[model samples]
Target: MVELLNAPNIDQYAWGAINGCEAASLLEGLHCLGKLTNVNYGEFLKQMPIDEGGNPNYGFGGSPYKNQAGKFEAIFVKPLADWAANYTTYEDLSDSGVEPIYQSVEAGNPVVTYVTVHFEKPEIETYPFGDVAINNHAVLVDGVNATQVHLSDPIDGKYYLDKSKFEKIYLSRNMALALLK
Candidate 1:
């Protein structure tokens, strides 16, 4: 199934008002799987851990919070998990992370994941968290075919990617993801 989340619109906390793409995908993924309902980016922003660094702490648009990649759990995933239905957050980072993602989708959980905004962007932007390209985006992985996972990108909308091509982007940023099951 294809899924999508509305990008944030707040300029200060996001690339725009829709800066919480990762959070957005998390909400949509869980909802699509019936693990959560009615949550959105505004809810994520409201629940995300707050700090003096504000937007950067949340790494809105892939920019680091005061140059730090905010804790994916505290700043993003866990809070959502607390609101979901019969699901717990389990991490499956690397170690063939792609397979676990597909497994989770098959087992009735979609992955809320991190990826570059675009597959072709160069890692040129500097941040205290680390150097990054423009679109450190968040998405939902709910369906898979033989070689690719179907995902919903908040900024780019819904699409599929070559499994190998998807891994290059996911692994680049530590294979960031949250699984709700």
Candidate 2:
């Protein structure tokens, strides 16, 4: 199964007119998963997931919002044939640290998967910026795996994300359904 996660360098995602909610909507519309920061989460623990040790893992759950609830919800997954049909096998990716956006890593072709929209806050620090919080950006999860996935921001920058962080941010089936249409 493929999962999508938000990159650490979310600050550099500034592009186009779409907002965080809009970007998420676009990804969900495509039936693809997205990894992004929940801007409403706030600072200190702003969009950062806490580890067992209580240290911020810098990760959080992700999902599609503003769309019809049952449209993407599938009944069952056929293992090898229909990975997309099963919601449990698939996961939404994200991280509290800066990471890159991607879809999949199948050979050389990078296919676009989901769309992400993030809001930028100046209080947090992030890549391409120092001392300034660079949060709130959107990325499309085009492809992925246990290693990395292909990602593209609206500004046309492409990159990859490690799998460990990808596992950190995922929405539960119930959580996903709550955000769906």
Task: Return the top candidate by lDDT.
Answer: 1
Best by TM-score: 1
Tens-digit lDDT string for candidate 2 (46-109): 2222222211112121222112321211111111112222222333223312132222223222
The local lDDT score (0 to 100) that residue 158 gets in candidate 2 is 46
lDDT of 2: 0.29
Worst 10 residues of 1 by lDDT: 3-12
Model 2 regions more than 4 Å off: 1-21, 24-134, 169-181
Those runs of model 1 whose alpha carbons end farther than 4 Å from true positions after fitting are 1-16, 54-87, 92-96
Residue 99, model 1, lDDT: 67
At residue 57, candidate 2 shows an lDDT of 18
Each candidate: what lDDT? Answer: 0.54, 0.29
Alpha-carbon RMSD, each predicted model: 6.1, 15.0
